[model samples]
Target: MDYRVAPAVRIAGRCRVPGDKSISHRAVMLAALAQGESRFDGFLAGADTLATAAAFRAMGVAIDGPQDGSVRVQGVGLHGLQPPAGALDMGNAGTGMRLLAGLLAGQRFGVTLTGDESLSRRPMARVIGPLRQMGADLAAEEGDTPPLVLRPVAQLRGIDYALPMASAQVKSCLLLAGLYAQGQTCVTEPAPTRDHTERMLAAFGWPVTRQRGRVCITGGRGSLQATQFSIPGDISSAAFPLVAAVIAAQGEVLIEGVGVNPTRTGILDILRAMGADITLLNPRDAGAEPVADIRVRASRLRGIAVPPELVPLAIDEFPAIAVAAACAQGQTLITGAAELRVKESDRIAAIASGLGMLGITVETLPDGLRIEGGQFRGGTVDSHGDHRIAMAFSLAALRAPEPVRIRDCVNVGTSFPGYTVLMRGLGLEIEEA
Candidate 1:
């Protein structure tokens, strides 16, 4: 689907985005590993997360209703999953495929995991190398991509490994696999990443410890007990409207119950540093996660050199941040984010191409993009089947001199379903074409 967005004078509304995709995936996986029924509220009803629920069902676990902010998972014990009848399809979810690969590594039966073209192109060697060290019998495509073949391993030995990059997926994959491995498993990251995995583990009654840059877990111990909890709204999703409100002519948007986990709030920190008038209101705990109401109003934003240390923290929000940069004063330089090249699309190149198509002066770097803040003019841009690219450009329309059309945007459903509807509600003119 293609999305057309027209310039808007103002945006005003109170909105709640879907559950955090990371937390939603973990909630389902951990709940399915528990021995009893677990009820979760605010589950994200998106294609990626639904793939996870379907995979669990194929393994003989029963999951009911992701209907209207709730899901009930009847977990099979840690040792109870049956070999799936055929290949497990993860759709567009890198998170689902990588994390599930680790969870299935120690099972007695073999399983094959596959995904859409985009996911199949993503590198799986990061997880493959670590799992092999833990003694997992695994194989991948020639390029170390998808169609990963995980054979049964009689025993998994724990190891103290260091991450070459700061990745929550790799860390969580190892930790989940650690649950079935023998001895203690420790993963040290070069920098801080999202802690949703560690937080959700504790919520499920499995204890983990984080000291400095490392997270350690002891495996082959107690079973995970089922628990009921609610997931906080995704801050990643809120980033669009937050940026939209900041760049709009006159607007105030109140986003409710957004997860403000310190590690994942890099976008917020960066926006504030760039002089956005954003406030966190009525902060409280939502289960093991922190939730707050975010109030954002239109402000004359000035470009600043984004701190390199916050790169991993705000990695996912860079596309939206690029939109803010396009409309800010002066220039914005984003560095230390070579990881952007390997996402669903080559995001570094994709962002530069898309923004350039809209008449913004963007220079593509080997690792990042240098964007000059100015006015956005209407034109057509390809999303390259990237959800963030599509959504970011749509927000760019708020400041466009004419309507902007984003193509190949059907992949938006992979993360934020009904994104067009949400944008339309905020007084922007958006339509599917």
Candidate 2:
């Protein structure tokens, strides 16, 4: 599948993107471990999130209706999950596979977790090393990549470990495993990452303590309690439309009910630094996360040196940031983002390649990219089967003189389903081909 996006004339409307993907994944996982039935409103029904729900179902948890962003999960308690019939396929979700590995480490039965090609290629050593240190009998296919095989461990001993880098997935994985370990497990990160896991853990009645950069949880201390939750709109998914509104020839766009957690607002911060006219309205709590309405208007963007400190917070949205960079007035320098190399694709290279095809001057660096602001010409770009790359290129069309054709876009549904329809509703000239 591919996307053909014509030049956008004006981007004006009020709309909402899908629910936060990270929160949706965690919601389903934690809900399945809680003691009773939990209802979730605004659950993302995308392929990646559904894969998490399916994995729980395979382990005998009953999950109903993700229809219209509503889902009911009947949790089987922390230790009540039944052994699956076979290897659990996580499809395209790296988050699901890593977190599930931790949750399943202390179980009595053996399990194997696998994924689609892209996910299978992602580095798992970050999560694997800590899990192994906790006494998990697990091995990856090539020492670092996925297809994780785990044998039942009679007991896991928790340890205070510090991450070499900041990673929400790795931290969350260890915390989940800490739930069953013999002692308290503490993790310290050099930089702060997303705290959805910590917040969700507390929401489920699990006691989690945080002091500065460290989060700690004691094993066998408490049980997860069922609770209702309402997920906020994904800022990652909202990035494309936000960039569209920023670079459009005319108009303003209001994106409602978006998650504005301080940790995940790097994209907004970076864009604002680049002179994007973005504002947050109606700030309030949506369950454990913060929600707000985003108002963005077309503005003259000026690129600047992106701070390395903000890299981890905006890691997933860099592709969209690249589009905004290309539409800016000067140059944008990105660094300290080596993590982008291991995502669903080599995002730095992928973004550079796609932008170059559109006549943008982009110089690829090992950790990041040096993008020069310039006009975009109509061209065809390959997404390398990465959903974010595909969507980012689609947004680039808003500033192009001609239509942009993005190939290998079949994977967009893994994160954001109904992308074309949603963008169209906001007046972007986009369609599936």
Candidate 3:
């Protein structure tokens, strides 16, 4: 599907974004392996998470409803995942395949994970190498693309593996495989990726621990307790509206109950660094995550050098941050993010090219992107089937001289459930074409 957004007045409203995609994926997967039913609310009903639920169901686990963003996962024990009758279609979810590769690698039964055209293009060697080191019988396409066939390991033994780069999916994939391995599984990284799996796993009553920089998982008879899980509001999804408020005309919008996990708040920090007027109010703790109301008012944003350390935290926000940079007063440099190349699209080039079509100056770098903040003339752009790119340009549309048309916006549903209605509620004119 295609989407078009026209220049509109400031977006103003109090809205609750969808559940966090990262946590929601883990909730369903972990719940599938638990001994009892895992009851969850605030589950993201996005297509990616739904793919996870379906894959589990195909493997003899039961995940029901979503009738109202509510889901119950009846988990089969550690060794209970049945062999899939056919290849597992993972859709555009890199999170699902990467993580599930580890989970299924150690299983006594064999399975294969496949996906859509786009997902079939992402590299999987990151998880493949590590799982192989830990005695997993896994093989992938020549370029690490999908068609990953994981057979029962000769011996799913534990091994200490250091990450070649920073990736939470790779780290979590190995950890999930550790569940069934003999001895201990250790994953040490030079830098920390999002710890949602670790945090959520601990909350689910699993004995996982971190010593120094290494997270060690001891494998044995494992069972998870039945628990109530509430997925936090997705910071990635909220970035669109948040940046819209930053650049939109005279608007003060409060996005309530946003998940403010430190690992996921890089965009918030980056915006504040650029001197954007954003306030985090009503701070409190719920669901083992810090939740707060995020208020943003149109501000005269100025570009600041985004530090490398913040890259991992705000990595997903880079596309939208590019939108903010396009409207800021100076040059913005984003570095230490070569990982963007492997997303649903080559985001580094995608952002640079698409935003350039809107008349924003973006200097493409090997591992990063540079955006000069200034006036933008509008035109159509390609989403490359990336949700963030499509949504980011919407904010640009609100500030442009012409409407911003986003092609291939069908993927937006994989993250945000109702893109059109949500933006329209904020008083912007967005329509599916």
Evaluate all candidate structures by whole-model CA lDDT and list the values in order: 0.92, 0.93, 0.87
Model 1 is weakest, by summed lDDT over 10 consecutive residues, at: 362-371
lDDT of 3 by residue, 286-369 (tens): 667788899999888888889877888888889999989988998999888999999999999999998789887889998998
Tens digits of per-residue lDDT, candidate 1, 293-349, equal: 999999998888889889999889999999998888999999888889888899999
| Best by the lDDT measure | 2
Model 1, runs deviating above 4 Å = none
lDDT ranking from best candidate downward: 2, 1, 3
Which pairs of residues collide in candidate 2? none
Displacement of the residue 261 alpha carbon in candidate 2, Å: 0.7
Instruction: State each model's C-alpha RMSD to the native.
Output: 0.8, 0.9, 1.2
Report model 3's TM-score to 2 decimal places. 0.98
